[model samples]
Target: MPRPHGFSYEIRNDTSVHITHQGRAAATLRAGRAAAFLAEVENGDAQLVMARWTGSYKFGNERTARNHPRNRR
Candidate 1:
């Protein structure tokens, strides 16, 4: 199946997490706390920090008028 347009995942430092459509850091957990992390994300209580790294797609999601809203065109 195709991936959801507004949902994505990130793998960082051995942790994998699902983020929301707004690019807000939804949840994070240690390798051993995968379930806990997901629980937080799902429970709407996680305060995950926005990820900062080179090549993150978050930049592309910003409201930039330089290109098409969806494709950065």
Candidate 2:
């Protein structure tokens, strides 16, 4: 199945996790690793960031993250 927009951590029946970003699959990690990553995120070992865009995709802007709006909060 296609991925969902934004961030999501989905656990599969086999105990593997599917990580998605911007409607795309970014990574697939084992359940153990996934848990560790989540722990890191919670402990501040990782920084989670997101960006959004406007102009209805008509701006023809690049998909590069450097141009996306950073999360200010």
Candidate 3:
């Protein structure tokens, strides 16, 4: 749950868009001003991509943490 590596994403401010390494949102893209910026992207394309990427990372991270040697029960 500690996302120590953090996520990666490319932001195209000129186009008001971004893309993750997996072709989704590279970071959390939190709600608020940042969300507002993502809203400007075409078809919310960048937003959708980021959402998927973040979700996937979080899920995978949680699964791995749950099975980690230190976390084992």
Candidate 4:
């Protein structure tokens, strides 16, 4: 799959992480979750990490599912 793009985050008063996708609000991580996100994001691909944190990452199943018998037109 193509690398995830258009994902960005902002830290609010050192208390939360606000994630956005293509300029729209996606999710907000608070307290412990925000702390964990900060740690992981600093060590990995930020875009991919944000996508995952927002539950938007692909699991490589779209193509297979689209071609399955039940989905065929």
Arrange candidates by TM-score, descending: 4, 2, 1, 3
TM-score per prediction, in order, is 0.28, 0.44, 0.27, 0.83
Residues 39-72, model 1: lDDT tens digits? 6556652333223211233444445545665766
**Candidate 3 ranges with C-alpha deviation above 4 Å:** 1-35, 43-59
The C-alpha local distance difference test score for the whole of candidate 3 amounts to: 0.49
Q: How many backbone clashes are present in model 3?
A: 3
Model 4: per-residue lDDT, tens digit, 3-48? 8899999999969999999999999999999999999999999999
Which residue pairs collide, candidate 3?
Answer: 24-49, 25-49, 25-50
lDDT of 4 at 4: 88
Stretches > 4 Å off in candidate 2: 1-5, 41-73
List clash counts for every candidate, in order. 2, 0, 3, 0
Candidate 2: tens digits of C-alpha lDDT, residues 7-41:
65567888776666666766777767767665655
Model 3, 1-73: lDDT tens digits are 3332333455454533344554444444444645565555445554344555455434446777888899998
* Candidate 4 structure, TM-score to reference: 0.83
| Pick by TM-score: 2 or 4, better one | 4
How high is the CA lDDT of each candidate model? 0.45, 0.49, 0.49, 0.93
